[model samples]
Target: MVLTNVEEQMSLRLAVEDFLFEESALLDDGRFREWLDLVTEDVRYVIPVQTTRERAHGSAGSTTMAHWDDDYIGLEMRILRLDTEYAWAEDPPSRLRHFVSNVRVRPGSEPDEYEVRSNVMVSRGRGDSRATDLLTAERQDVLRRTDQGFRLARRTVVLDHVVIATHNLAFFF
Candidate 1:
């Protein structure tokens, strides 16, 4: 017999939760390359800028979207750049720990896709700078149960913190 809506949602939620745990584990362990491999080649991974004026209107503006946003090639280039002799972001590198919880899955219009919402707490120590960045957001993902496995077709991370505490936009959430 086939699965019902609740069952399907449960399964998808577990898949995504697994993905999140693995991804966070990789990041925490400093296995960036392994984490990078999880993302789709043509992934639409972006965190748009939010404004205060958008309070009455909304949160984001399309114009503030990253000028040189990443595709697979761009992500790869970033990896290569960081793997070089002179990478400012990672001369010594920072220690990071990501805490994720309260994962909620909302089934989407498409059968293979769902809306995932989660709370995040990212702690990092770079040189003398110590900070525990907190970003509560909902991740809208279009997941596909592909031949390879469940892969994200699209993911938009809508962060609750309009003014970010994180120093760089280098990590994938």
Candidate 2:
């Protein structure tokens, strides 16, 4: 069984859409554990800070002014924080909606992997919270096709808002 370039492209394109939708739903549903399963053990999820310098170009450095640069462990800790006795940030829990679209799959330089990019828009609301529309940035994800399925190895999130005005991020992107 094999596929031509067109078929592969179509399949991967749909897969990316499905993946984004599924992940978004998972986060909205508060299925953190399940979301964790979607990522590889060596996953990297970063939300790099974008300065107010421009309308598009954000900070590239992960350490520059990033509000978050999380690995698996860090992600897990976030979940734990939410479950804490007094996690003020999420005491009432914020409702989030992740809108992902315009996924473009670039030609894979590696035979077993793909370099994918997409645009994300997240809107969140909570009691007494200003209903922050977060730095909906672009993401560059490196997805690897495995025997099981497509697994995320790396994800770099370049936020549109370099300076986050909201509370701490306890949610998964």
Candidate 3:
């Protein structure tokens, strides 16, 4: 059966949402290795530093400083560190729950690519702690269509809070 333009768009949107949900699940389940497969070899993942500024000024996120600005190699190194016994920060491993919402998908500048914007709220709980730290952010991503599926090409995470309350950022977003 042939599909109309709208139908095709709807299908693509659903696929993007599914991809994001699956990625979140992988992170929540602490399956970093599996998650790595979802990104392209030259993927650029960044989380810019957020600050409070006056209304007259520009955006709150700074262009210079970043909490995380990593390429595929850097990401792989982080995952490798997590796998070792010496990575004391994540020795116990935090329980995580990633909630993705408000997904908007549109055509990217490049062919076979989609620009996706979404809101994410991550709940993280550490050892013997009933209290859960919440991290909320808006993510802009570029997903490229491939034979396997849609793979993350680029991602820029803008956090809601200027001051992070969490002990450590050992988990992926």
- In order of appearance, the predictions have TM-scores of 0.80, 0.84, 0.96
- Flag regions of model 2 displaced more than 4 Å: 1-4, 52-63, 128-134
* Model 2 residue 50 CA deviation in Å: 1.6
- lDDT by residue (tens digit), candidate 1, 1-173: 23477877687778889987887898887787886777777677665665556467764635566523567777778777777886777667767788888988766666765656677777676777554555556666665556666666666676766677767766566
lDDT of model 1, residue 142: 60
lDDT (tens digit, per residue) of candidate 3 on 124-165: 988898899999999999999999999999999999989999
lDDT of each: 0.69, 0.77, 0.93
RMSD of 2: 3.3
Model 1 residue 64 CA deviation (Å) reads 3.9
- Answer with 1 or 3, whichever has the higher lDDT: 3
- Model 2 earns a TM-score of 0.84
Q: Give the candidate order by descending lDDT.
A: 3, 2, 1
Model 1's alpha-carbon lDDT is 0.69
- True-structure lDDT of candidate 2: 0.77
